[model samples]
Target: MEQQIDSLFNWLDETTSIIEQEENTPYIEALIAASNLLFEQQVPEDLEPNYRTQLTNQVNAIQFSDFEREARQKAMQLAILKGMKGATQQHHYITPETIGVFIGYLITKFVGGQNSYRLFDPASGSGNLLLTILNQQQNMEVDSYGSEVDPTLIRLAFNNTNLQEREIEYFHQDSLKPILLEPVDVIASDLPVGYYPDDDTASSYELKAEEGHSFAHHLFIEQSIKYTKEAGYLFFVVPSFLFESEQKDQLQSYLKEHVHIVGVLELPKSMFQNEKFSRSILILQKKGPQTRDPRKVMLAQLPSFKDVEATNNVITQIDQWFKNDR
Candidate 1:
């Protein structure tokens, strides 16, 4: 499974490398189609006619290999990580595997007993959360889906998770909008934080939109929960202000009526370290009337900064909390 995943990333690197050199080539669509073919063995039938032609014109150039692919993919991922300076500009905040894996572990504990499940990330930048979730559930079958507003990151994410037999879907659209698919069992993401132009369509998120300013992270949390099935879980990495500031009260009240606050883990101040952002993980469960309990919540603070062992211990502690509930 790992080798196949590596090969998919290699395809991403190769396609992106080609598109970078041919900036005027309109290769993004073709690259995406080619990747679909490489892993899924077919292009999506809904692709436009022009995109199909563009793909046909470039498909032959995509080479495949059994041995060299893994190393090449790693090189490509590293290159993008180091060279894609615009990643942050595009709101592509990559979650560290350490944190992501811990979240995945908790999510696994919550939903692991099921025979199968669907896990989604509303703002799945670069597909790290979905990939991490898959890593934690090596023995379980999971259908992974995500949506991103940036087309470039969407392509990168689609490329990263397009494993041979894995079910993965990447949508290049705003996650604040409703997804047409059925509600998922688990929704987890490092919610993008910042104020952007208020999306008119997001008027439904009453508390999230005010006058001309809209806080994106709040909206995503609402949207994520909207698509989460009853009793489904949601895990999000959000700015600390969501818990500390006056702005949080409205959303908090809204959540109290809709979902159960599973826990709020305040990360160490150094969690974002050099990034100038303080973050916390907020866990929630979509509740039916019978399951709603506003007081049933846990609050935890991570250990001292730079202590990996202590961090792991905190992760284990949280994992056990969820385990006890099960």
Candidate 2:
């Protein structure tokens, strides 16, 4: 049974090596040790841990490993990882693993035409956004392009998103800085919500920053729309004000000249309030001749952001909106 378990769990060894090269292995290594220790500690000292077969003592220590015990261990390990990985190395951190998966699923679903494509995350904090895109792209080459103003965050994002050894372009500059690069198909971003440090607080030692906005919707909205090519999509998660604010009409007008306001999934503001909602993914497709017949806008939002399960339902409904309504 010990040999059998070793064989079965050997994949963890391979996974460890893979992540190690990317430098994401330390967390996993620590997790394995912790998992082993916690599981062992849970067992009663007096009774010998039973092997896979209670009938025989042929098994080694983990011979006592049961589905519940093993699964519980894995769950704890995963929970720890989730917590540790939750904080973004970059400023204005927002994306989480679950949210990343959700975004990846959508991007993967959309990008089926090209053999490969450049992925642009205007606000690529810790590369979670790009990683999510990579997972969804299957084996397709993802030419990642993202910018971070914070130098430390640029390093962290680059290190964190060590993408299958794929060549990537990471910039350590303000994402809002104008660039002369050619247009890309997808521009997905999660903008920052708060204000930057004011110059007054700085003794000239710290980098001076600007004032805060009631909403970052306009800023990123304008940038993404301008940068994206006609017919390419700009996916964003912004404050709830992006939806149906009085200014929304003006924002829509601006988009009309450049792109179509195709989809708006206004998530509950409170979704991230419990450290959850993250507002919502507002899907906007640039207008072009070949743009789909389903040019009408689709709105997916909750009355409020409080209930997470409802927000999840909103996610499912958003998926359904693309399929059923599209």
Candidate 3:
């Protein structure tokens, strides 16, 4: 579905009278009100009364108090989140369209010949990755699910999907925390990278955490693994350090025993919009305790992000590998 995000912004700009305002709280309040109206209009007419009412109440409860101290920065950051401005990629929220498309194609090929499947994104920012999959797999049927900690971004994601007439199940909760849901067939996400304050403790992520450090990103990966069904595939973007970090040896070992590392696509340094740290896409498949011979993990280096042809060429190679190997 076409994003009418601009229309939402226009409504806020006109009604909030904050077109020239410099304050953050006012803009946030206006945004909350506009978001409610946007979702209200997009909600399906045939939706169950209780479900629709619950959604409407959630929209109504979007208040200034819902945001933390970084309210202004969050508001400004929405531009990048919504693709209104080019993403710098330093934040936990930016999922570029190129990366989204690449992962979408992976999902399509991995689920080849399947008419319908469930797709989940643990850290779905504005539902870009999930929506990209819906666009790519138009001929196939899918039920999209996602969870996010940020209320603003989740609101944007909700409106984006609903506006397109795609009914998605989105949870406004931290993906790093425990969530009980039906296991899905495919799990794909640009996992949130970096450490932050969270309710999930370091002890819970003993597999991926170092002493005195608890990474939300690792917890998200753990959750993704937990939610994926046996034999389901998980496609995630993570820091390159994970591949070689001595601190992550235990976590790597655990992963090796539990799932096959199908492949790792090394991305460009500029892939995160000039972030110096490198990133890679790790594709894994869940397995049972039964022993199986390990297949060669496909490792391919992508060309510079600026070279569109080179990037597409690498994607083609990756697609061929998935097709032939499976």
Candidate 4:
């Protein structure tokens, strides 16, 4: 599998380099290369004839169908990670595969047995995390949707899912703005953290700041909650200081009114470069006639993922809690 992923990534890198010679940025080159890989044809008519021919020859050498879905996804992830390295934006980070798999496991715990359910990721960057979750739920039917504001990322996302042969409805716009989506059974996001720039849009949110710009992460939480069905679950990768900031009181009040806190699992500290930058997975269930608060909110400090036995033990405990408590 590793070799397969490497081969696919090498092809992407080479193709991207070829496209880069046309004076495009690494990000654009990668997106173009990936799209060409997905369609198994060169889509750019504007490329120099020589570069176009080289890309065509490279594309013809590999059978994309020969790679497993996981291999293809991982290869694309590598290509995107490389592209992001050259990007100027600080928030172009891709979710680590381990974290994506962890979130996918949690989602499966709640909805795996259902016949079908709708899932949405409002901050689905490059569709990596959302696709990771979808890969885990292959046994069941899922209506998946992802919204991303970045044009480059959304195009990469479309190409990624298309190559994986997974169907997802995508919305390209500010997720904090009014979305025309029906409430979903589950909402998951590695919430974008920062102050929202648009005061007009921020004014409409319950978590909007009274004196200044609202925290984008705070507004994302509210927006996600608004698009979640009653009794549905929300899993967010939230900053460690989420409830310790100046606006904690208002955010807490809003959460208390709309949802029941189900769990807060602190991710392994080793996963982050600094303690202050670490995040936790916040689990909440939207209040509904059928929903009740758990006897105790699930809380745990997860061990380093490298400690396989410890990680497995924690997962077992989580499974037992879900089976016997909720």
Which candidate number maximizes lDDT? 4
In order, what is each prediction's RMSD in angstroms? 5.8, 11.1, 8.9, 1.5
Q: How accurate is candidate 2 locally (lDDT)?
A: 0.56
Winner by TM-score between candidate 4 and candidate 2: 4
Q: Which ten residues in a row have the lowest lDDT in candidate 1?
A: 67-76
Against the hidden reference, what TM-scores do the models get?
Answer: 0.75, 0.60, 0.74, 0.96
Residue pairs with backbone overlap in model 3: none
On lDDT, the stronger of 1 and 3 is 1
TM-score of decoy 2 = 0.60
Q: Rate the local accuracy (lDDT) of all candidates.
A: 0.69, 0.56, 0.67, 0.88
Residue-wise C-alpha lDDT for candidate 1, range 190-308, written one tens digit per residue: 98887756567657786655566677777888888889999888999888778665567878888887888878888777665554577788989899755755444667887754687
User: Which has the higher lDDT value, candidate number 2 or candidate number 3?
Assistant: 3
Candidate structures ordered by TM-score, highest first: 4, 1, 3, 2
Give lDDT tens digits, candidate 3, residues 1-326. Answer: 01233433334444333312322344434454445454454444665687556445544544323333223223323443444344354443556666776787778877889999998998886776777667678588898898887776787677556545577899988677677679899999887766656534556764545555566667777778889898888999888887566557676777876788888888777655555467888989899556343456788887886798997787787767655664
Q: After superposing candidate 2 on the true structure, give the runs of residues whose Cα lies further than 4 Å from its correct spot.
A: 1-92, 194-216, 244-249, 268-270, 274-278, 292-296, 301-324
The C-alpha stretches of model 4 lying farther than 4 A from their native spots are 43-46
Q: After superposition, how far is residue 309 of candidate 2 from its true place, in Å?
A: 10
